[model samples]
Target: MESPHAVLLVVLIATFAICNLVQAEDQEGFISLDCGLPPNEVSPYIEPITGLRFSSDSSFIQSGIIGKVDKSFETLKSYMTLRYFPDGKRNCYNLIVKQGTTYMIRATALYGNYDGHNNSPKFDLYIGANFWTTLDTGKSITGVGEEITYIPRSNSLDVCLVKTDTTTPFLSLLELRPLDKDTYLTTSGSLKNFRRYYLSNSESIIAYPEDVKDRIWESRFESEWKQISTTLKPNNSIGGYFVPQNALMTAAIPANESAPFSLTEELDSPTDELYVYLHFSEVQSLKANESREFDMLWGGEVVYDAFSPEYLNITTIQTNTPVTCKDGKCNLELRRTKNSTLPPLLNAIEFYTVIKFPQLETNETDVVAIKDIKATYELNRITWQGDPCVPQKFRWVGLDCNSLDTLTLPRITSLNLSSTGLKGNIAAGIQNLTHLEKLDLSNNNLTGGIPEFLANMKSLSFINLSKNNLNGSIPQALLKREKDGLKLSVDEKTRCFPGSCVTTTKKKFPVMIVALVSSAVVVIVVVLVLIFVFKKKKPSNLEALPPSSNTPCENVTSTSISDTSIETKRKRFSYSEVLEMTKNLQRPLGEGGFGVVYHGDINGSSQQVAVKLLSQSSTQGYKEFKAEVNSSSNFC
Candidate 1:
């Protein structure tokens, strides 16, 4: 047997090694993000003063807005906002994370009536296309947030803002903090829900250097509770428990020593079951027999009857409390013991509701097929990175996936490759997308017999292969399917006859030259004859019309000419008349990326006209306008 001194030395060395290893891992895996912090800018991969890299939502979402919150409140004046997603789909913020590591992710939504509409918005939050929670800023203009602990299966995590019908979804803040291994364990491999409150009577919103983890510790409202501060502060960390490092730096004691301090929260529904945690630490040491004791009551039930206070050491009590929000309220109270001299005090409190997270994984077969197709055509128009269909918010560009509620695996429903400049045979990998409903391969250089395997795709309802150089007869299966409601568009000029693949033949050059010469001789003879007739009927005595015409023609002055055909009826309007009809070009309907579009009402008709004023500096605007005019004339 080893000596006691040797054993003690060995144990000490082992403990020191373990601590060093843990510290190294924490530094390597920890990540933090402060979303929408600096205003009036779009940043991608910007490292702020906090040393954590974050990106704005502008790069991921195309349409929406970003701005600062109302500055009337001092605590939240520095925060920013991202809102107004009219499309009901999800807009995601992709964060790079280590695979198979547990992370605590939190999102804060502070409406503060940012739009000045004085209305709060409610919407669902998502994690990599899976439903996480619903953020409802019910009545409080302060802030509302949700926190969850999850282990990401992939290297990237997609946090999405999902819009609802009644209101647009938005996000104000987001933070991701990696946790120590074996900290929050789940037997069933599911996510844990947590709510953290920074209980302080002082008006300090603690974060960053104060909290270190960058967790938002909301300060208590002084009006709701009277303040009590301890002169002798306790150690910052709690023992053996996962309490925040700086949570106990400040503490609060109730004002009235005789009455219990209580807190009540309003839940969205009455069916919420929660797990509660209360953290406590003694600020001042008791002299001799001076003691402070308390009993905790949750919803009229006594949970802890004789809870004694401890100094320097931290104590945490946990309970599984199933609470139904009667009148949408759940109450908790902390009362002093009958024999105690001091009032009850609390450092922090948390409530976590139990929920099952969705298991989002892409279908394996669809993944293989889509990846192969991407490789075959070298389709680089859109970035084809990551999984093809797992996260609905970050699906492969130019593709649509089926929305499955109960089922997590997604199916490819549509493939739009129109005008993608793809030049090759229709890839056989497409056969693997069994659920494909529509396929567009128009306006490409694809030259080959139409693949017959397409007819086997039962759900295909639409196919476009026009403006291609394909020269094979249409497969009978496709033709038959077209008759049964599958809309098909194939160019007639390149289509060949069935059974022999007989292509249209071109005329010889000699025959074309002979026909061109004869046409030119006939055109010369007609021109000579017209000239001779014009000379014989020359009006030598005819006088030209007067340069100035005072005679009025229906009191209408032609000021502008329409760009339409000469034979078409043209109506002219003077500059003043145009201004009168447009109301001096005021009241714009909407503004696009290039110009502002105005709404105008014309006189003598019930029609409303839209006038778009192109920006003078727009170089491409003139080209687009001319092309549009030519196309319209040809169509008419």
Candidate 2:
């Protein structure tokens, strides 16, 4: 070791030489850390490339790959099969490192297994639980080991080796530490669906999904940096963003000063800046007589020059600055920009942004769209909106759609459009939905008789015509099914005969099958008689009409049609007739997921019961209670 006096003199000479050489460059302190005097000591059994080795309190480490081996600097004899296992290619290393320093830990090992039985091992580098990354061992006989990086956010992180296959050689080591940092930035973007992916060393190998609200980026160098930056372009779908720590978290700068990275760091809004502490090696291959200083550039322009040709503090180097000098180290910090209008680029020299974006607009049902299916009520005001509808947004409280099939003409079986602070007559267009089984428009300022078209919907099992200015006679067909206990104050049963029938809670199963069967049998007999009478007078060759005629219609006109007109007409039941048949009663079939279904007799039809409900309690209960009542869960 040189004496203190001698070392002081050497430092002064180096500093003076550095100052004179960097006259045209940015004047800043430069430094570097070195591996003990060995040109190339191959860790044939371990990771490649050294990284930013700066120390910090909140340690965040990423890893890198092993670089190509140099013949002269190679220490192959020293490379022993530290943990040789030929079957599964499984190997482990116990890396001893200091704590409270942010590190990017990357390991690159050559794969030697080629048999079909060869499988990748699972390996992890840990510094307690706070720092660790797991890599899936792979089969790569090409000698380029699978590159994976990890950034441990905690303090007790450590590294662990995994061997997935117990058959092939455990794990082989070839190249080591090819990169300098332990984070990922996909220039073309990340592996889709992966929550987090990192690359060992310099290559941006990590890609984290923006699905989460907060995101973290780790430093790339083995040495700490003075500042760091992450930039993101604006995108509603890109996601909201965040960074882990500020510069106050650790040491001011990295040990390496060879070169550095840049990041966007300004926001019109109140945003924080990143302060990184990076570390890298600044090597200078010089001849014994060569003593010239060299200038260092990051992106382009020179930051500082080194007389001894080594690393410098390039942290303050402006964007595009040159990291020109050889045999020197570098570590720098860049800032991130939020919500910029610029085009999005993952590797635009320097840019990174992780977002947590939210979804907007959920409810947008229109009433004017359905005009044919009129209800026995006035159609009125539903709030208007221009935004597109999404599921969890847009304040659509009580509009539930059929679940079985979400697409197709939506089955609007239920609706609770009450007290939306809305004003108007119930929309007549609602009856256009023939599938509507329930309707609740109570406690609103609606006037006029309920639309008659509502009765046309064969699926309507429940009705709520209460607390409105409705004056027309209640449609007896709507009363066929009793729902919630209703007020007997209104005469909802047969008004054509002036209270001709009092509807009862007792259920009734239809016997209409007898009439249908009898009618079919009668029609068959009548048709046979009429055909025989007409055929008696026809010629035997009457079957020939036209060659291309689709239907076998008789050529007989008005004169021949009148002979059997009565028999041709089947017994047709009018709308009023079906209503009269429900005068009889039966028993309850019990309630289902939707409502109470009953076994009722409509004229002679049997086993034709209905799902019935009178009124929803929640509408008058809560403004949004109506949507829940229309639970698509029953069918969807």
* Alpha-carbon local distance difference test for all models: 0.60, 0.29
For model 2, the stretches where C-alpha displacement exceeds 4 angstroms are: 1-413, 417-424, 429-436, 443-445, 456-459, 472-636
- Please, what's the RMSD in Å of model 2? 27.5
lDDT (tens digit, per residue) of candidate 1 on 199-286? 7755344444344444545455434455544655455555434554446655667666687878776654567666666778776667
Q: Give the C-alpha miss distance for residue 537 in model 2, angstroms.
A: 83
**Residue 508 in model 2: shift from native, Å?**
22
Number of clashes recorded per candidate: 0, 168
Q: Give lDDT tens digits, candidate 2, residues 1-636.
A: 111111121222332332332222211111111111122432111111111121111111111122222233222221212133332221223233333332323333333232334454445322221112343434333222222222222222223343334432223331112122323322221111111211112322211122111122222333333322223222222111221112112222222333232322232122312111222211223355533333433334444443121221112212221122122222223221232111111111122221111221121132223312222333322211111122222222454544332233234556665553323455656666556667766656666555566666666666565555555555564444333332222323322223543332211213466655664455345335433543674321111111122332332333221132212121222223222332321344665443333343332442232322212221233223223323311221
* Residue 345 shift from truth in candidate 1, angstroms: 3.3
Q: Work out the TM-score per prediction.
A: 0.52, 0.21
